[model samples]
Target chain A: MQVHIPLKKVVDNSYDITIDTLPKMNFDTKVAVVTNQTVSKLHLDYLLSKISAKELHVITLQDGEEYKNQVSIDAILESLFENRFNRKSMLIAFGGGVIGDMTGYAASIFQRGIDFIQIPTTLLSQVDASVGGKTGMNNKYGKNLVGAFHQPKAVYIDPYFLTTLPQREFSAGVAEIVKMAVTFNKEFFTFLESADLNNPKVLQEVIKQAVQTKASVVAEDEKEKGIRAALNYGHTFGHVIENETQYKKFLHGEAVAIGMVMANEMAVKMNLMSEKEALRVKSLLEKYNLPVSYVIEDVRKFYETFFLDKKSSDSAITFVLPLGIGDFVITDKIDNGTIMCVLNKFGKN
Target chain B: MQVHIPLKKVVDNSYDITIDTLPKMNFDTKVAVVTNQTVSKLHLDYLLSKISAKELHVITLQDGEEYKNQVSIDAILESLFENRFNRKSMLIAFGGGVIGDMTGYAASIFQRGIDFIQIPTTLLSQVDASVGGKTGMNNKYGKNLVGAFHQPKAVYIDPYFLTTLPQREFSAGVAEIVKMAVTFNKEFFTFLESADLNNPKVLQEVIKQAVQTKASVVAEDEKEKGIRAALNYGHTFGHVIENETQYKKFLHGEAVAIGMVMANEMAVKMNLMSEKEALRVKSLLEKYNLPVSYVIEDVRKFYETFFLDKKSSDSAITFVLPLGIGDFVITDKIDNGTIMCVLNKFGKN
Candidate 1:
């Protein structure tokens, strides 16, 4: 017998994102803001001045993608438990995607689940990670292989934190903006190609567009069972690169920028996408100073790493290949020979 | 500003539950059938004969309610990690309520989460533990103060396993049956009051009714947000008794048997239940040879322990009092003086 259970009852986990500034959110529960040292140094006082919680605790970890692991998740959870946080307690993920994912994961498992709010300090997180309920710590196995789809009660995105962000990181965030544009919105891609991101107005619009595209997709397939996987456009290749480089060579967005180029090569080889459109994407990425090139030492070795990705299953290796500039196809039927040809071109280039 | 995202998803965890006799369920994943030495000695080979897994493992723990603690949960998880059981694995709980709760808790947190199947050998588990997804290990803080609402993929209730169950344990299961009947089903209570439990037909009907009732309730409220809390009819006082005894003296259901009497006493004093009806309930419990009395050493100390229960919140203790023979009311408004009066009566009696 099957019962149709409706998902309603107004789950009251809501947070606001201000592209221009951060807002003070008051709470009675014990509060822990998990952040990185860089973000802490820049905005901790600004954040502290704005909020009135019962007790405010800050846990700052080293800033980098390498630190987004189980140890980090453990540290955050241990701190919460040590502080005697109850069910009503909240965690504020107050940094970039690394801090956001690790903090979100800690919230998911600490006492089997609790409320957390995202105070994304980076543009990449504001546009990408903050809106998605994906929470996890990376393991040696693969990126996001160990994660729970835990939605934050609210996400507060303040572009005020963006003032102190380095240019490279800003470029990285633009890479994600480009990813959102390429995967779902052709008009947005065209708009971005012509827009000057240096202007605050255009950057805010960019964040809004990226979040809207993500929010719409997340609403349709929150758990990545279908069209949501399209969001992993540059990620399949990016994850392999990150693993190969030990997550130190490039920023996550930069690696994804290169990955988009690699996937475009595959699309070009398969005649699924025009070379002209691929070049257009590359040119746009280069305009943002996003890395559009990476050297793959071994084609076969690189190929083997894709299977390890949690996204790839036993029967086939799923590829999210761009169709033209804004549309994409998730196909696993592409033969290895075609894939090898695309990999070889990257080597020769 | 806000986006509605569906964070919960039906995980790709589907398993068949064959209820006839017992089928051999062995797989390639590292298997750990967490059973006690007593059950292991009697039914270990019977279980092994059925389970033909790639790496069949057995970690028999000591038998008894006292053994269900954080130490056991850690040992189970440690064993799984030591055996290198990855995220895609299974843990079979092969004993009573203690084994079921501990195994389920271990699976819920092992590497953040894993799959667990319930093979309830005790009547209490088959009727109570298996239906609700409540899984946890007892800590020094209190019973189930540390737990998660982790549903098992499936439950296999093979009555053949219950044949080896001790008479005391058997009566303990009856206590849960009475609690279920009184709280939710008036007709079930009426049937139970006259039902010949020794007869196979009667026992099967009672088990089916209790399981179906519990399953339907869980399906509606997966996370104890509403009607699910009603299931804890006799658990409030029972938890205090178990804690006082260090979970050693009485079987879990036996403790509940005495707890039901205490709750009925409070109900009679509060005018929620008639004294004559309360006596009828006590007589039914006595018919099963279940304990229906306990000495309250210190009313103040016993009252303090109620606050430690996960269900109780600040300044109020929610009590599930039997309104009559087959009805219960969940309330926190039963004043302190009235509660103290009931405790005093128990001491004097």
Candidate 2:
């Protein structure tokens, strides 16, 4: 007997990413705001004041990228179970990308997924993580090695949260914003070169531009099958960098800033980007105080680290490089000679 | 700025459930056959004789329900990362329901979702677990408390595997078959009552009928929002029984068999089912040597266990009782007095 499971339905996981203000949230079902101690202490009252639920709970986790692991995921789930939360109950992610990722992962696995809303408080998360449905936690193998593509029901990005962000963290976020401009919009990149983001109005516009650029890319490929891989513009190099540095030396966007620089050198070798064009991207990154350089302790070891990344399938490492700003090319054709030559440039003295 | 994710696409996760003969499987990508010590010893050679892959790996977990936890899930994931299996890699679940659930879960979380196929050897998995996309592992809270709904790429069912199955396990599988007939198909119930499934041909047909019943139910409701939940008919009671016994005394199907009888008793009290009808269902279960009774130690404590089930949302315990042989009534309306009375009847005197 041949039984065909006829599953044909239109799935609409689409949600709005609202910037500037956090609206009053009212839920008939139980809601848990999964946050970190750092974010909760700073903004928990502000977040709690806006929500009214049949039963509301605050689950505070230890703050740090290191805390993003299975243990924390288990804690969030344990809390939900303890509170007798069900599939109808919701989770609110109320921190940086770490909280958003962990909350979304917990929501995804708790009773086979429930609704989760993102209230990303960090600059990097607001512009980059907010738009993508990628939710995950880090394991010993690599970052986001274990995760799911569980989308948020909605996203609330308030510029007000950025007021409390540290300067280095602020620059780390600008790196991601620059990534969006360098990959998709030339005019946006040009504007960013001189944009006074200190002016809150300009910052809001920059966030909008970055988010809109990401929103469109994610809209095309939600699962990162095709065009979505382009969004990993500097992430291939960045992930390896993070892994080498044990995710402590740099914030995600800061590593990506340097990763973008490393990728540009390769692009320059390929003649897709000239030295001047690469220098322009570096200048824009420097303007935001983002680190644009790193010394690879061992070029061979650094090159080998690329294979450990989840993006590298089989023996080939797919590199997303600049086709001269505002456009890009994803290729696996770069030989070891080219890779080693480019990597050796960043080698130790 | 407000950005819509724009995710409106028809997702077709539908796949064929081929019964009787296993097809010659081939994969262009890396393939890992996730099975157990028992199944692999009995049938791994037979399964390996049918497939070819770019790179093949066999991951064996401890062969019991107790092994179904985060540790096992992590083990499966760790093997995958160590093997350098990327997004293009596929997992083949080659044991019973436990292996299927864990493998599917590992695939769901590994690098945020990958493809998997189900080769269900047990009658229970072939008829029930293989059809629905409910993939998860049990936790301290209850069965399948942490999981996701990841539909398999395809499912292959071969009746040959059952020849080596233990009689108790075979009877347990038959319990699920009876569950399918009781909830939705009176004709199938009549067929099951008189049919001698000892004849391989008849058994294949019965499995077909049960799989078909489940296929249609799952097709209409994948996420268990409305009609799909009705399939949890006996499971609501069964889960509590399984929890009470710590999943040690009886197999899942045996517990569900007893649970159905408990539900029938409740239905008889509610006037939804006659005493004769309830007996008929019990007799059918007895024909397969399925357990149809349990001794509750504490009526109130036993009743409290119902809340621990993942199905019970908030404080209300939803009960699914038979409304005659081919129909059911899903309601949270049954009073605690009625529940206690029914539970006390099964209590130790």
DockQ of the candidate models in sequence: 0.21, 0.88
For model 1, the superposed segments whose C-alpha errors exceed 4 Å read A1-20, A24-37, A53-85, A109-112, A295-304, A337-349, B1-119, B136-154, B240-251, B274-305, B334-349
lDDT of 2 by residue, B183-243 (tens): 8999899998899989999999999999999999999988988878878888988999988
For residues A16-65, could you state the per-residue lDDT of candidate 1 as single tens digits?
A: 44555666689987789888999989889988898899888999899988
Question: Candidate 2's residue-wise lDDT over A215-327, tens digit each?
Answer: 99998888998988888888999999999999999999999999999999999999999899999999999988889889999888898788889998888899999998899
Supply candidate 1's per-residue lDDT for B150.
73
Clashing pairs in 1: A13-A153, A15-A154, B24-B50, B27-B53
Best by DockQ: 2
lDDT of 2 at B295: 97
Assess the local accuracy of residue A126 in candidate 1 as a C-alpha lDDT between 0 and 100.
Answer: 91
- Per-residue C-alpha lDDT of model 1 across residues B1-349, encoded as one tens digit per residue: 4434444444333233334467667677667889998889988889888887768778889987777876787678667655656556789998888899888877876655678888888889988887677887676666765566677877887878878888899899999999888888888988899999778667767888888777767767777767777888889999998998888888889999999999988888888889898888899999989999888888889998887676775467889988786677889898999989888876734
Candidate 1: chain B TM-score against the reference chain B: 0.94
Candidate 2 collision pairs: none
**DockQ of candidate 1 relative to the true structure:** 0.21
In candidate 1 the C-alpha lDDT for residue B165 amounts to 88
